[model samples]
Target: MGTIDFDGLAAALAVHGLIPRGGIDFAKGETAPPGPSGASARAVLLVGHAGSSIWPHFQAWRATQPAGLADPLDAWSRQVIGAVAVRFGARAVSPSDQPWLPFQAWAMRAEGLRPSPLGLLMHPVWGLWHAFRGALLFDNALERPRNPDSLHHPCDACIGKPCLKACPVAAHAGGGFDYPACLGHVRSPSGSACASGGCLDRRACPVGTEYRYEPAQQAFHMAAFASPSIASAPTSGG
Candidate 1:
């Protein structure tokens, strides 16, 4: 058979809502990850659309989950990207993996992405509506992904700073993320707005309006944010 077509591979995966976020050529970057895969030529990051492209399929699949399936979102993402990695003879990784890599740094270098007011990586076309699901290490080197259309950091240009003001409890204001406050509000009856529509802070960003996730997708994230078990989950980055 012909050599594996990485571009075609990317295009095919995109159909399933798994898109390439960025890639690094270990042979070329000034800095490299420890234990650089001698078996692989490059590392590529993949992002899953939690509330937009991924919603329809995820909902359909989640409907079939038996009662005991814990962390269905993570499980489903691993299964999907894991299958893709296997098909291409590559290694797959999850965002929640131990010994976490700096995904935010990778995204910034790969696509010139910048952080929003709340520190989530902001995409010119996606704002805060997107998330990093997983990544892959390929046995072959691939082309560097394109920079997002707008080189300017949208947040820098925004005068309103609505994201900082939208939270009911000011969870994201005053230079720190008040996680306990956010969780408390989300779990309370007052969190109905965030529960149904997604984070008011995230939704306030005006950029990438067309790329916003659907309400169904938003609800899923809100539910997760509201989960008590997640209070202890470690998160330096997404």
Candidate 2:
């Protein structure tokens, strides 16, 4: 089998529009929690980037000039992620893996890895505005990095925890988010403003403030909330 040069892989992803930031770890001999498919050959953790144009093609699709508006970013995201997986020579797993929630809980308890104020691994450069498109699990073992640094958690020092405070319905309190409540609000008639204003709580985060999503981009995601399948997707922790 040919050896995989992870650095080269990262560079290729960057060339293909992925942010291509952060560490890659080998999972060959490690004990992974049981799940749908077996453990991945390696686990790549991508650090979020500010103003990444990874999905710009989708953004353009949303701007139908004649009709004045179109929205297809989610479909575009899936296609982009699938292409990346094929390029990496690995099986692609959806971002939502129900069995992985236990692992996320474990990571939070053992590693001080709290979900970002936006309910993700808060990135210093992207804050809570970024996402993991998909994970590529190779069949062959690859060399992994040592001593990967833990990313800075901006919520650690914030006094007001603006993210938690910004939610109009207090959806992010008591250690768990009320998904239904949040979604209900987003789909309600009163939620039209959110479709235009973006996520109030996510925008409230001070870290990586410059990386905030454009109104159109936010609207695309907000519309996704109305999709039952996407909204109820199982969480996959990084």
Candidate 3:
């Protein structure tokens, strides 16, 4: 019932390297994410970063935390985004939360994104270098449904499909991701390029080459993905 200045909210979040990716309004015949009070929200705004936009901010914050913090990136996202939600009377939720919210689906709908050969949502400009950190669920519809008309999916026209060929293990062959093969390769002695330089398949995507994550960022994500204790591939696209 209360009004929100969506642009103003975006500006506030940008100060901390968070961008408003997109959103869905239940009033427009779409389902919404759960609100803070456990009720269905009226609208949900996807929050994320493109490329290494949040790297510096995250590093600064990480420096202040205790050493060996588990899931520091997720912790930082929750904290920074949660503060903004409080100011706007909205509820902030993460992709890692229980009953995992449909973040990938929400992102595709909100941004007119399509999955690339690598299985990550591909942006026309950012490619697979972007990711959803969290979402803000509001009690009221904030805007009209987004029009995906002008948003183009880049994969269809890419003739070479270098991303599919880049992997040494052909983990993306046959239109499906070979999770075990990919994981094993990343953890192997011969997988130094991927372990230290990020997933070769992802880096091979020609689009958004400018947005490719820096070496340190790529290494950090690779380390997480290679960790024995990690149950799954990192959801973060960095």
Model 3 weakest lDDT span, ten residues long: 229-238
Model 1 vs. true fold: TM? 0.86
Q: Across residues 117-189, which tens digit of lDDT does each residue of candidate 2 receive?
A: 5566665566766655555555654455443245567778888888888777778865678877888888888
Using TM-score as the measure, which candidate wins?
3
TM-score of each: 0.86, 0.73, 0.94
Worst 10 residues of 1 by lDDT: 32-41
Clashing pairs in 2: 116-120
| Residue 25 displacement (Å), model 1 | 1.4
Q: Which of the two candidates, 2 or 3, achieves a greater lDDT against the reference? A: 3
For model 3, how does the per-residue alpha-carbon lDDT over 1-238 read when each residue is reduced to its tens digit? 6787887898988998889878877665456666766778888889999889899999999999999999899899999999999988889998888776788777777777878888798899988889889889988777665747347779999999999999999999769999899899988998999999999989988889998999999999899878777865335455
For model 1, how does the per-residue alpha-carbon lDDT over 7-30 read when each residue is reduced to its tens digit?
A: 866775776776766666555654
> Which portions of model 1 show Cα errors greater than 4 Å?
1-4, 27-41, 143-150, 231-238
**Residue ranges of candidate 2 with Cα displaced over 4 Å:** 21-52, 60-75, 97-113, 147-149, 228-231, 235-238
lDDT of 3: 0.85
Against the true structure, candidate 2 has what lDDT? Answer: 0.57
